[model samples]
Target: MSAQLPEITFDEYLNEQLINSLNLQTNVIQNLAQYSRHISFQLVDIKNDVEILANRVIALHQQQQSQFLPPLQMFVQPSIPPSNSLCFFPPAMQVFPPLHKPFFSTTPDLPNKPVPFSFSTIEP
Candidate 1:
C-alpha cells in the first residue's frame, strides 16, 4: 500500500525553505571555523620550526667564531684595474679568509711550515 502525502499551505512551504536555507548557512559557518582553526595550527607549527632553525644557525655561528674559523662573509673583488698592489682572489678561493690558517694547515707533514696563500691581482 502507498502512503498518502499531506498537503501543506504556501506559507508553510516558504517557511520550510527558509529553515533549510538557515540550516545550510549554519553548516557553512561551522565548516569555515574548522578550516580556520586548522590553518592557525599549521601556522604555529611553521613558526616554531623556523625559530628552532634560527637558534641552530646562531649556535653554529658562535661555535665557528670561538674556534677562529672564518665567519661566512662575501668577499668581493673591486672592479678596479689589476695592479701589483691590489689583491684579487678568484671566486673559489675568496670564501675562505686568511685568518683561518691554523685550522687549514693541520697536517702532520706541514707541522712547522705555514701554507703560503697569495691573492695576487690578475692582469687583464
Candidate 2:
C-alpha cells in the first residue's frame, strides 16, 4: 500500500522560491526542464564570459597569424615535391598482387549435357 504524503507548509520564502523555480525552467518542451535559481544567473554570466572569451581568442588568433606568418604573394607557385619520393604499402599485399591479369579456373569451358543418371536403374 502507498504511504500517506505529508502536506507542505505555506511560507513567504517558499512561495517566492516556487514562483522563481518555475521561471528558471522552460515550458516549451513537454518534459520537465529545471535549474537552480543560482544556476540560472550563473549560466547567463557564463554565456557573457564565453562571448567575451571567444572574441578575444578570435582577435588574438588573427593578430598572431598576421604577425608570425609571411604575407600572401599573388604570383607565387608552391615548390613542387621532389620526384624521388618513396611510398609504402600495407601487408594486405600478400592476398593481392599488383595488376596481374585476373585468371579464373585453368579448365576450358564445356557444353551442357542432359541428366547423366536415371531412376529406372533399380527394380521394385
Candidate 1 positional error at 59, Å: 1.0
Model 1 gets an lDDT of 0.62
Winning candidate number (lDDT): 1
**Against the true structure, what is every candidate's RMSD?**
15.5, 29.2
Tell how far residue 48 is off in model 1, in angstroms: 1.0
Give per-residue lDDT, candidate 1, residue 77: 51
lDDT of 1 at 53: 70
TM-score per candidate, chains pooled: 0.50, 0.31
lDDT of 2 at 14: 98
Candidate 1, residues 1-124, lDDT tens digits: the string is: 9999999999999999999999999999999999999999998888777666755654554455567654435575545445875576655654535444433354232322223322232255
**Tens digits of per-residue lDDT for model 2 on 71-113?**
3333433444556756533334324332322133442322232
Clash count list over all predictions: 0, 0
